[model samples]
Target: MPSATHPSPPDKSRAGPEHDLTAAFPTMDLETPSAIPTSGQCLDHLKLLEAFHVLREDVATTDGLYGIHDRFVDDVYPSKGLDEKEAQLLFRLREKRWAIFVANAERRYTIWFQNLPSDRGRMPGQLALAEMSGYFEKTSGIAFDSGINPPLDILMVWHAHLLNPHDFLEDCIRYDKKLL
Candidate 1:
């Protein structure tokens, strides 16, 4: 008796923990696909975009501090300066280099995450976080890449903690002030 424009409300009697909506409405076709990305895909895309922006900014800042752009031009073509096209290409190359570096770091982190023990609960992770914090506190004067790398387990926790920037900053300020 329902018209095409106004369908009857779904039966409340059929709605319960054991009720299956698909079985109740076989013709509803709830599995229809769309162009929209899933929430996980959207999150991955957003993270990639943010990482791209951060890499671009880091490259620009490094160039400004070290005169990498001028050095590139001088080393590649001393006699004649780069044209607009060549300048753009140089920028792209630098961006690509930074992207590769970031990609490698992400790959390492992924491997580290995958190798974590399944049986152990949060204790291992908490210990790694503590170790990472201690490393930062003790190595205040040492360069990050000064021939020493933090353990992968510690780095994994540090990386995850860093994703929540506000919490990380607050914890750093409270307990690990030297890390700031």
Candidate 2:
């Protein structure tokens, strides 16, 4: 057999495994995004799991909800603080005193305004579960719809549990008499 000298086997002893892309760069660590999840993403998943666990515990303990005295904050309702312009607008409307008209109408037509968040709050499905139809009727004499238009100074109302006795007493005293 005749021996011929070639390129000396291309120095494959230094080359690493077929899957070793990291071999090119010693400092790099190769791993898929799915293998090691992000902290923020993991936290979100954990929160969801915690919420589910709490719901299950509540259901097991409460036995299908007897009157549902929500201790935790709902953060689903709508509320707003009136601004100067808003106050002026409402004031002007009241000053008209249309009820005093001696022509035909005896009662003043009442128009109730409600500020609801169309997005970033409670979903429409959850609202249905809470039986919000009565709330809608009492507030605006209509039905509650999630797709309602934008509101002025719309904010979400969170119904937190009354953990403190002082807060409970303060709220009771503050709202004791609607009219003084």
Candidate 3:
């Protein structure tokens, strides 16, 4: 992992000409809520935390090139092909989202992240997209296609269905009505 102090940014020269991602996500708050917040949402935050920890560990024990992977993963979001600065920017954005989730517990919220399905045609290559959709489908009281891959594929939504806000609400309503 590379030292955070001298972390390399992705090369601007290698960036794809078709898109200007820096402009696309000018700020983190521009992101929309694709699904409601739940424990899986919190776990995603934990994953980012773990990723960050791994980067720190690499920086401390190795030459810091390993640490650069964290930045690389960040920059490669959505479409890929980003410079180092862009990658760091992406990491910071995700970190901000994680922070918000940690700091605010009372507020009802939603989950939105990078690399989601913008075009229906792009779905096949994206397994995470399918997973998130399943989670939302099952919990949101909406029917997701049964054929779609389940949320288990992405390492989110593991057995904590009760942590899902929709499922939580459904259980509450059912209990209130003496249906459970």
C-alpha lDDT (0 to 100) for residue 176 of candidate 1: 30
TM-score of 1: 0.35
Q: Give per-residue lDDT, candidate 3, residue 65.
A: 30
Candidate 2 local lDDT, residue 87: 40
Most TM-score-accurate candidate: 1
lDDT of each residue in 1-180, candidate 2, tens digit only: 101222111233433475333233443232435667766556544544444334333332341133332221122222254444444433333223221221111110101111222234333223342244454456534444444321111101111212465664564344341111
lDDT per residue as tens, model 3, 1-180: 233454443333533545333332233342456566655456555554444444333233232232333444444554545556554664564455444433331121113122233333333233455575676666544444433222221222222333586875664354341121
- Candidate numbers sorted by TM-score from highest down: 1, 2, 3
The list of candidate 1 runs beyond 4 A from truth reads: 1-48, 64-70, 111-119, 122-127, 134-180
- Between candidates 1 and 3, the one scoring higher on TM-score is 1
Check candidate 2 and list the clashing pairs.
71-161, 73-159, 73-160, 74-159, 75-158
Candidate 3's TM-score reads 0.19
Q: Which ten residues in a row have the lowest lDDT in candidate 3?
A: 105-114
TM for every model, in the order presented, reads: 0.35, 0.20, 0.19
Give the candidates in order of lDDT, highest first.
1, 3, 2
Error of 3 at 150 (Å): 2.8
Global CA lDDT computed for model 2? 0.31
